[model samples]
Target: MNGKEALTPREFLRIADFFATNGYRLGPKIGEGTYSKVRIAERSNNGEFLAVKIIDKRIAKKSYVTKFLPRELEIAVLVKHPNVICTYEILHQGELVYIIMDYAERGDLLQLIQTCGGVSEKEAKRMFKEMAEAVKYLHNLGIAHRDLKCENILIMRDKRIALSDFGFSRLYLDQQHGDVTSKTYCGSRAYASPELLRGAPYDPRTNDVWSLGVILFIMICGKMPFDDRNLKLMLKKQMSEGVTVPETVKTQVSSECVRLVYQILDPNTDSRPGVVDILQSDWLN
Candidate 1:
C-alpha cells in the first residue's frame, strides 16, 4: 500500500479487515497519547511481537496529526535503517488509524534514564553513535527529524537504539531548490534549538543535532541541559552563556564527550556539527 496516499474511512476499514484476516492479534495497551493508544500485538503466523498504535481519526483530524500523519507514515515506511524503528503496516478501521511497528521490549531511553538515574559514559557513547547513524541516514534521504529526544529513542533487547516518533519530521528538499529550510517551531521546549526558540527560520537538520546533544546530555547527566519551564530564561542562557556541563558531570564524563556536547549545542546553529561530523567524531569512533 502507498501510505502517502489519503485513505477514506471505508478504505481504511477494508485494510484493517485484511490485516485481521491475516492473523494480527491486538493485545493489551502498552502506552497512550492524547489521541492514540499503543498496544502490544502478535503476528499469529510467526508469533512475533509488534506495537500497534491506534489513533482516533476524529481527534487526529482536529490535531497536528491531520497534517503530519501522511508524512509520518511515508517516512516510517521508507526509511529502513537498523537504528530506526520499523513500521510494518498501517491500517484503519472506522474512526481509528492503526500503525503496526517493531516492538522494543526494553522501552525507551527516557524510561531507562529515569529508572537507573543515568547510563555510564560507555553505554551512552554506544547509544549516541547509533542515534547519529540513524540521523545521518535520514539526512541522506533528504529527511529531517525535528523531534529527536530521549523519549523518542527506543532501546532494543540487544542494547541497540531505534529512533522513533516521526510526527514532527519533514522533508528538507523541494523540486526546485533541492534543499530547503523550515520555520516551524514545534518540538519539546528543552530540546529545541536556539533559532527555534527565537521563532526564527532554522535548518531542521541542525535543529535535530541540537536535540541529539540534549539527549546525550540527559543520558549522561540525568537532567535536561535547558529549562523548559522558563522559556525566556532558557533562551537567554542558550544564546549567551551556552550549555553548561555541571562540574559534577565534567568530572565524570570524558573530555571528548564534553567537547562534543558543547559543539553540538552551540547557540549558533552554523557552528553545530552535522550528523556526519558527529558520527565521525573521535568520541563516537
Candidate 2:
C-alpha cells in the first residue's frame, strides 16, 4: 500500500495476513519522533533483529503529513550505503506507517559520548571519517540531511558509524539542477546553523555542514561548542567568540582537529568547508 494514501478495509486485511505470515515481535521503544516511535523487533521465525519505526499518520501535523514525511520515505528507500542504516521494508497498514531498518546494537554516538566523556583524537578521526564519507555520498546525490546531530549517528557493534534519521532531509536542487534555499527551520537548535537561527532562507547544504561541525566538536570535546539555552546568545557565540573547549580536555584534542572544526563551523556559509573537504583534511588522514 502507498504510504501517502489511506488504506481500505480489504487492503488492511491483506496486510494483516501478510504480517501474520512473516511478522516481527515488537520490543521496547528505542527512539521516537513527534508522531513516530522506533522499537526493536525480532522476526518470528528466525529471530533476525530489526528496528521498526512506526509513524501514526492520524496525529501527524499537516506540514509533516504532506511534506517532510513523504520526502523521508522516498529518500530513506533511495539511499543504500554501508555507513548508513539500511531500510528492509515499508508497510502502510490503515493509519500506520511501518519502516523496518537495520538495528545498531551499540546504540547512538550520543550514548558513547556520555559513557566515555570524550573520545580520543585518534578514535574521533576514525569514526568521523566514516560519517563524513556518508554525508559526502548524500551531498553528491543532491541530498542534504538538514538534521546532523550526534544522536542521529548510530554505532554498530563493530563501532562503525551509521548515519540515521532523514525526516528533515531533502534534495537541495531545483528542477534545472540549480541550488535551492530552504526556510523550514528544521533541526535541533544546538546544531542549527547561523542562517537557520536568523530565520532566513538558507542553503540546506551549508546548514548541514554547521551541524556536522557541532557533532565533531562534541565528539572530541565531550560538550557542546556553544550553549543554546538562549538562541540569541548561541548565534552570537557561533559567529564570534569561537568554540570553548572544556578546561579538562583542552590539551587532549589536536590543533589540527580544532582547526577543521572552526573551518566547518564558519559563520559565513560560503567559507565553511564541505564534507569532502573534511575527508581530505590532514587530521583525518
Candidate 3:
C-alpha cells in the first residue's frame, strides 16, 4: 500500500489539512496490536519517512494512571537511549493519543527466537551484552524495568536490541534502597523470581537479574528451564531444584556463561549476583 493508507484516521485528517496546505502520502500498515497500531508513511514535501503508533484516546483517557494520557506521555518523553525505543513526538487529536517513534523492522525478541529456533552462542552473547548494558543504563538512571521479557526486547535494523514498555517500570531516584517488601506481585509467571513467588521482601535489581537469567536460558535452549503443566509445580521446581541448563544448551554456551546463568538464577535473592557481577563476568567482558 501507498503512504495514504498508512496514516491513522486522526493522522489522516491532520495530514489531509497539512497536505491541502502542502503535500505528502501515507504508506502501508506495518504492524498492529491490541492497545495500539503502527504504520509507515512518507512526507510528500521532504520525502521524510516515519513510523507512528496510535492508541485509542478514549480508552487511554479512561485508563486509571494514564487519565488524559499524561503518564504514557511522561514515559515516552523521558525514556531515550540507543538501546531503548526512541519516542519522537506525542500528539493529541480529539480523544486519541498518537506516539511517533523509530520503527525496528525485526520486531520483538520472541519472534526472533521463533524464526531462528533460538540464537547461537555468539549471537546470544552479543545480545546478552547489549541487554545487560541497557539494564545497567536504566538502573543508573534510577529506573527499574520491572517487566523485562522477550516480548519487551525489540530488535532494530542493525540487529541491535532495544528495551520497550515502561508501563510497569519503577523509577527510584533515592540513593537509599527502599523497603524490600512488595505487596503487589508483578511480572510474567514464567519469568517471576523466587522472592516474588514466595511473596517476600525483594529488591528490584535482584529480581531483575533472575529474570535476565531466565531470558538467556530461553535464548540458548529454545524453551524455559522450568517446564511443568502446573504453575505452582513449575515455580516449586525453579525454587527448589533450580533451573537446569540442559546438556545440549551447555554445549552451545560457554562454561562461564552457564556458570553465570546459575549464579543469577539462584533462588535466594540475597545471594544472586548483582548487576555488577553479571556485567563483569568473563562471558560478558
Candidate 4:
C-alpha cells in the first residue's frame, strides 16, 4: 500500500509485534531529522542489523506525506544496487511510520569529512566512483535524486558508499517523452545547480550532476564551493565564477580530478556531463 493509507493504532502495534516475534529487536536511536528518527535494530536469530526510520504521523501530514513519503517509498523499493541503500519493508501505525532499511556502520560522508578534515585523493576517488555508479543507476532507470549531497551518502565499515534519502527524488520522464524538465527548487542551496537558483525548468539529471560536483569538491576540500551566508554574492559567484579549485587543492589533488569537477560544475547545465560519462572519466579510472 502507498504511505498515504491510514491504519489504526491496534493495526500498527500488531504489525510491530509481528516483526518482533519474527526476530527484530529495536535498539538505540542512531539518527534524527526534522520529521523522523532512525533507530538501530537487530534480527535476534541471525544478528543482522537494520536501520528503522520512524516518522511521526502528525509531522508527515503537515509536511504533505502524499508528496514525499509515498514517492520515497516507491523509489526505495524500485532501486537495488550495491551503492544504493536497500529498503526491506515499511510498517505503520496510527501515529507513526517505520521504514526498515540497511544500516551503514561507519555513518555518513558528512560525518567522515567532519572527523577527517578532507579525504585523501585515494579515498576520494574510491567514494566518488561508487557515488557516480549509484547516480548512473538511478538515471538509467529514469529517476533523479534531486536532493543528492554528502549528508545523504552513507559509508559502510569497509568504506564503500551507500546513497540514501530519496525524499526529493522522482522519475523525470515517461516513455512518450525523451527528457522531461522540472521547476521544483528543492535540495541544499550550496549544492544546487545554477538553473535551480535561477528559477527555471531544468533537466533533473544535469541538476544531479552539478550536486555531485559540489559533493566531490567537498570531499577533496572540506568546504562548500558555494556558501549560502551571502546569498546574492554566492549566486553571482555560482553564475560567473562557477567552481574554483583552491591552490591548496591543486597542490594535493590530481589535475584530472580538478578538471572533472570543473566540467561537472559548468554554469551551463547542458555542458554538465551525464552520470555515465562521468563514470567513464579519466579521473575516475
lDDT of 3 by residue, 96-175 (tens): 45676777778888998888889888899989888888888877776777678898888888999998766556664544
Q: What would you estimate as the lDDT of candidate 1? A: 0.85
Candidate 3: clashing pairs of residues: 2-27, 3-26, 3-27, 4-26, 24-44, 57-95
| Cα lDDT, model 1, residue 112 | 98
**On residues 134-210, what C-alpha lDDT tens digit does candidate 1 reach at each position?**
99999999999998988899988898899998888988788797657887888788899988888987889889999
Model 3 residue runs over 4 Å out of place are 1-27, 32-34, 41-49, 60-71, 174-183
TM-score against native, each model: 0.91, 0.90, 0.82, 0.91
Compare candidates 3 and 4 on lDDT and give the better one.
4
Any residue pairs clashing in model 1, and if so which? Answer: none
**Model 4 steric clash pairs:** none
Q: Considering summed lDDT, which 10 consecutive residues are worst modelled in model 1?
A: 1-10
> 119-215 in candidate 2: lDDT tens per residue?
8888899898899899988988889999999899999878899999999999888878675898889999999999999999998888888888999
How far in Å is the alpha carbon of 253 misplaced in model 4? Answer: 1.3
Better candidate by lDDT, 2 or 3: 2
TM-score of decoy 2: 0.90
lDDT of 4 by residue, 141-183 (tens): 9899999999999998777899998888988886686658987
Give the per-residue Cα lDDT of candidate 2 at 212: 87
